[model samples]
Target: MHPDDLSAAAEVHRLAFVRQKQSEQWLASTLAAFPRFLCFVAEEAGQVLGFILWAQKSGFRDQAVLELDQLAVLPAAQGRGIGRRLIVQSLPLVREQLVRQGSSLKHVIVNTRADNHAQKLYRDTLGAQVEATIRDLYSADEVFMVARQVDEGARGR
Candidate 1:
């Protein structure tokens, strides 16, 4: 996402994640993190409908583990495959950035509410499987899903 898209992306975040406050500030900080935190927006007709945040976990290495930090879509724009597209399209871009840094993606990890239907999307898109579940974590039970050996999966597309 470009710097100019921050406000619009922040609005999506605000609407998608109503429990989260300071949308603009949160997104701005994540954007400033740059290579450590790769942020991408899904837009159509010059409007940001959604965004995804992928973060490099731990320190830099020859192999990188990425966290699907956040995914948000405006309420009005939900169920349109925008979130799925963000994952499918931006992942290659993320891999390119990792390649430039002498690292290849090794794994992707995601933590989401256990009851969230997005788990199916993660499974279908990233080959992610639930490895653990933390009870009463962040508004509900949180499941940690991992897609291992992802570099061998063509960016998990």
Candidate 2:
């Protein structure tokens, strides 16, 4: 997303997370440095209803692991499969980037609030596995759950 889209994107982010205002400068800077970091929006009649931003990074211990940095859909648009569509579109981008970098991606990892209903959509609906649970990682009262998508060839193993 560009600096111009920050206002709209921030609005979506604010509605989704109920947190501090997202910085336009930060988004612009990050997008400039990493163009592959995607910000996808669901728009109808020229109005953006929701968005999902995601970035892929090599894991610290395993270079073959691709970590999803962020994913969120506006609260008003939730439960309509917009989030799932974003994730589904992102899988190929992740695979393409890995191939271009000559890396063999073995899995995709995402982190979400442990009690979040979205967790079931990602885990049960999308077939992601809970890889780990980090207590109080984001806040004193919140727990973080790491979910993983193993490559098709590694699914049964």
Candidate 3:
């Protein structure tokens, strides 16, 4: 996402994640991280509707493990497939960035409250599956999901 979109994106973050505070600072820091933390926003008619953040996990290597760090859409825009579009659209761009760094995406990891319905979205889009569950990790039980060998899956798309 461009620096100019920070405020609008942060608004979406605030609305999507009500429990989280300091939206501007959180978004600004992540945006500044660049290649290590790739951030993309979905906008229409100059209005930011949603965003997706992917972070390279651990040290960089030939095969990179990425975390689907954060996905947020304005509450009013929810259930309209903006979140799905964010994932389907930004992932290829992320793959291209990794390729330029002489790296390829190996797998993707996502963790969320067990009850969150977005698990289905991850499954459909990234082929992510729940690998583990940590009780009371945050506000509730958190499930760790992973999509293995994404290089092939990513290529097919």
- Could you tell me how far off, in angstroms, the CA of residue 143 lies in candidate 1 after the best superposition? 0.5
User: Could you give candidate 1's per-residue lDDT for residues 77-107 as a string of tens digits?
Assistant: 9989888899988889999999999999999
Residue pairs in steric clash, candidate 1? none
lDDT of each: 0.91, 0.59, 0.91
Task: Give one digit per residue, the lDDT tens place, for model 2 in 5-109.
Answer: 667766776677765455455456556655346555666576666655655554323346555555666677777776766666656665566667665555556
Write model 3 residue lDDT over 1-157, tens digit each, in one string: 9999999999999998888999999999999998899999999889999999999999888999999999998887888888888888888999899999999998999999999998988888888999999999888999999999864434222
List residue ranges in candidate 3 displaced over 4 A: 151-157
What does candidate 1 score on TM? 0.95
Cα error, residue 86 of model 1, in Å, equals 0.3
Following a full C-alpha superposition, what root-mean-square deviation does model 3 have from the true structure?
1.8
- Mark the 10 consecutive residues where model 2 has the least summed lDDT: 148-157
lDDT, residue 31, model 1? 96
| Candidate 2 residue-wise lDDT at 66 | 54
Compared with the true structure, the alpha-carbon lDDT of candidate 2 equals 0.59
Candidate 2, residue 85: CA error in Å?
0.7
TM-score of each model, in listed order? 0.95, 0.73, 0.95
